[model samples]
Target: MARPIWSGTLSFGLLNIPVSLMSGERRTDISFRMLDARDNTPIRYERVNADSGEEVAWKDIVKAFEYDKGSYVVLEPEDIRSAAPESHDAIEVEAFVQASQIDPRYFEKPYVLVPAKKAEKGYVLLREALSATGRIGIARVVIRTREHLCAVMPHGDALLLLMMRYPQELVDIDEYRIPEGKGADYRITAREQAFSEQLIETMSGDWDPTQYQDEFRERLQQVIRRRMKDKGVVRREDEEPELHENAATNVVDFMSLLQQSIARKRRTPAQASATGSDAPQSDGPAKKAAKKVTAKPAPKASTKAAKAAAEKAAGAASKRASRSDSSPAKPARKAVTKKRGKVA
Candidate 1:
């Protein structure tokens, strides 16, 4: 069973909905460890004093604030505990803002807000209200002894609480260099605008997450499985086929390529049907050829005698074709020529 990381009441005005926060997602991936190459042993890290170049005990470490260059004021655990946020079990809603008002970059971790025991009525009410308003709830909540700026928003029939970055945590956007444009008149032709709109229409489609996959992950897992089965890693083929220098320069005509692809697809069924019909007719000639090519006792002969025997065999084949009325006899001469050419 899943456990709730936080349990609190979502409060706004006089409304209070008891909710339990639970982590919604997880990552499963291969992790690597740093190791000593010589002995293949895992390497460990140590906290050290930078100035002294010596290891420091965990107990000796304290949070510090750097007030000046090369100077720091250390604060103890007790000092931080005293300065911690006030403990609050409630999520205090401050305002309702348009969902689009928040920049996605400010969003951080997410948690599912499930209705607490006996709080189903209040939870449904808040979910319906937010859905109707189409606005997200801006709230503050303390989690893990730290106050977090968060947004409570409706997702389907439930609430999704996302931690947001504090204003101070984000760098000012204006600090980065931005491109400047000269004050000049610019115009777009009506034809160009219409063509751009048509191009967008041609590429538009509904978003379907099911059509996408992590192909790299799947391939990596296949490799891992093969390795575990005691198979040595298979190297990829090294041969690179020589490409025609003017292949791209020749430029494939798009319309012709599309027509060719359609034609190939249309021919597939016809090709299959043709093969099915020809199989029976092909069997008779194949059987006759097999019988004629069967192994026979060799006749001893001199070089001249061997040439004479070859001429006799050719004469006999021609005589058999003249006697046979079957259309198969015509192809027999072509097959013999092809076979002799291959052998030579």
Candidate 2:
């Protein structure tokens, strides 16, 4: 099993759950080394003092912050450590918010949280609660020496801790000249909208990340292989390394909260609309078409009801035609008059 990057207690209210943090992303980008053009030798970088122009050792290196031009405030390791959160081994949740409320731009990175042995109850409880409520716990976590703003939310069978950028780190949308609501100023026509919607419907499909590949990396690798073949020496690739999941207290309270969460049904369409969780709301033809393509199947009961109503309407129309054909008055008048005229 892979070792956990950080083992810590996840705190919310009076509950504490022991958890381990692990990386959730894999990077497969090919790397290249800087080389001397003339000799094809790897280039080396040196840390040198600006004043003396002498190389510095790793042991002598210290971090510093430049406050002004040609002015720096030297900080020691201890000083940096002291500035970290008081609790290094805890993820302190401050509040819970609807996950839909978070802007996509603020999400930085994703990490998985695993419950320690025998601590699965609290972990599962939290995950289930978040999943049911469609909310995430906003928390402060100290990973290494830096404190990060993060959100703990449910992802399938696991809890995901997503690092978030601070509000200051995000550029305000108002800074850009975004077109006003629905781009009515653009004078888009209903015909254009219908065509756009049809295009989207034709192109839409379930998201499959594997379909996307790094073409540049693959092409570069092909080139390298070709060069090796030309030289009559091909290098064999090394085998890929094999890939490699808590505890809890407050049983009564946890169970109570969990049961309530489970009992609480998912948000209704009206509620979703009110909360703006049903995003990209529109009444355009394209939006309607998209819904037609993506909407869930109607309930069996609803289908039966519609069929029954159609049959009832047909039966009612047949009864009306029968009544008209056998009317008590004014039905035989034309035949009787024609017979009398023929006799005269």
- Each model's lDDT comes to 0.75, 0.78
Q: In candidate 1, list every pair of residues with a backbone clash.
A: none
Q: For model 2, what is the error of residue 53's alpha carbon versus the real structure, in angstroms, after optimal superposition?
A: 1.8
Model 2, span 74-167: residue lDDT tens: 9999999999878999999999999889899989999999999999999999999988999999999998899999999998999999999999
Tell me the deviation in Å of residue 315 in model 1: 50
Error of 2 at 308 (Å): 87
For candidate 2, the TM-score is: 0.64
For model 1 the TM-score comes to 0.61
Tens digit of per-residue lDDT, candidate 1, span 243-336: 3322323254433434433444444557858766544543557667656666222233344455654565576586885575457555555555
